[model samples]
Target: MSDTSPFDPVGHESLADAVVEQIETMIVDGILKEGHKLPSERDLAEAMGVSRPKLREALQILESRDLVTVRHGEGSFIAPLSGRAMSPALLALYARHGRAFYDYLEYRREQECFAARTAALRATQSDKDRLRDIIDEMQKAWEEDDAEASQEADLRLHVAVVDASQNTTLIHMMASVYDLTRQGVFYNRRFLRTMDGTGEKLLQQHKDIVATILAGDPDAAEQAARAHLDFVEESFRLGEEQKARETRAAKRRKLSGQASR
Candidate 1:
């Protein structure tokens, strides 16, 4: 009988969420407070009924929102009111459905807007040439109707702008979490479809952005970036809203059928 199992069994599909909730509740209930240092990673992993990876994901979410902070060579600590930071969980939740799409897009727009502004001031001529090449690649890919490749090219162009800043910190910030932003751009996969000649419009926008960067005109570069982002943001927001409405209507009809039965 090998010492008779000392514990009972528990079952839940999303154990990670449950663990996160428990820790969150403890913090809310005053068991844990802001600025309080948490146990070492090893200790917390042992204390929680979760794997290190799961715990790390939870901690990453909190860190993104500034709920926690991990200093170099030090353990994690609860963060003070550090304002809002971009959390992975938030991005995933937003990307899950249409309603949350705009939120994530707006967040991305703000980040990119700043990146463009900085790059305008800091980008070198070589950086300008690099960005133009990426845009040209996007045009070629789109012409070939290679939707996936086109999208990648588009992202590369934007990421190139951020990279042109030659600022690793900024590049790292964008690279760290860009999946949801990228997905939201093609939200509902609509980007794969023909743009009905919107391609030229988009191309001009890119040209304007690059021209400003080359001319060292920070104001124009920032505005061009914002304008381009605004168009994409609006398209995503409208499409997402429409999808959510359709989903809700479908749910209602399903419920009505069950009730009739």
Candidate 2:
């Protein structure tokens, strides 16, 4: 994973896309640091077992996304992350595969519980203050009926908790998945709206988690965090079931109408 050896070429029709993904993975995983010079075009093409034209196409796509900078006659270099962690390709991958989102949530739930527990034991007064401020913003967002602001505040609260843990590794892990976190919140917003009283329940859940942490009760903080996620998981499950039932009923009605004709 550390070395940039030749990639094993899979027989996919979209070779250029594959090339883009491989390069993107390297960048994301820190194998290719910012401002690091990329291999020469010819060498890179050979290493990837892709045609030069295909490699050039992939580089162009990366350049378009600001993941790579192509200086004329100077080859290519990895671009500095200007606060952009989510690539269009990565977003497309998640959008195309619904199961990936569920898998991500399950992983996030565990990490979040640990973060909350650690935060309870380690948070400073300043950390508590920051958490409270975010919660205040969240409350205001909900009161104003601004879903987008509420969602952003919700993410900030969770991230703040993770930071409060004073665990650098945990912080970095969350940062790596930052894009997926935002996407999940946005995607789940539609189903979240369908669950009655969900907004109020969610607000209270956030408050409970923060209050437990602030009390320095690690056990309670962990429990509160897990309980909040349990509700979220259930909401998603119920929402999906409702959507499925509606689809089936619609199909039955269509079939009955055809039979009558």
Model 2 is weakest, by summed lDDT over 10 consecutive residues, at 1-10
After superposition, the stretches of candidate 2 with alpha carbons farther than 4 Å from their true spots are 1-91, 184-186
Compared with the true structure, the alpha-carbon lDDT of candidate 2 equals 0.82
Weakest ten-residue segment in model 1 by summed lDDT = 1-10
Clashes of each: 0, 0
Candidate 2 positional error at 71, Å: 15
Give a tens-digit lDDT track for model 2, residues 1-261: 124464555346898899999888766644465677988988787777788899899999999999999999899998876344467786787778766767767887899999999999999898999999999999899899888898899888988998888776677577666656676632655457558464888889999999999999999999999998888788877877888999999999999999999
Model 1 misplacement above 4 A:
1-92, 182-189, 192-198, 244-261
RMSD list, candidates in order: 16.7, 13.6
Put down candidate 1 lDDT per residue, 1-261, tens digits, no spaces.
123322122135665566566666665433344566877766676666466787787788778766778886888887764222446676555546555655656766777777778888888776888887887887787677676776677777777787766666566556544544465532633452433244656667777877787787878888898898787776655665777999999999999999999
The local lDDT score (0 to 100) that residue 13 gets in candidate 2 is 80
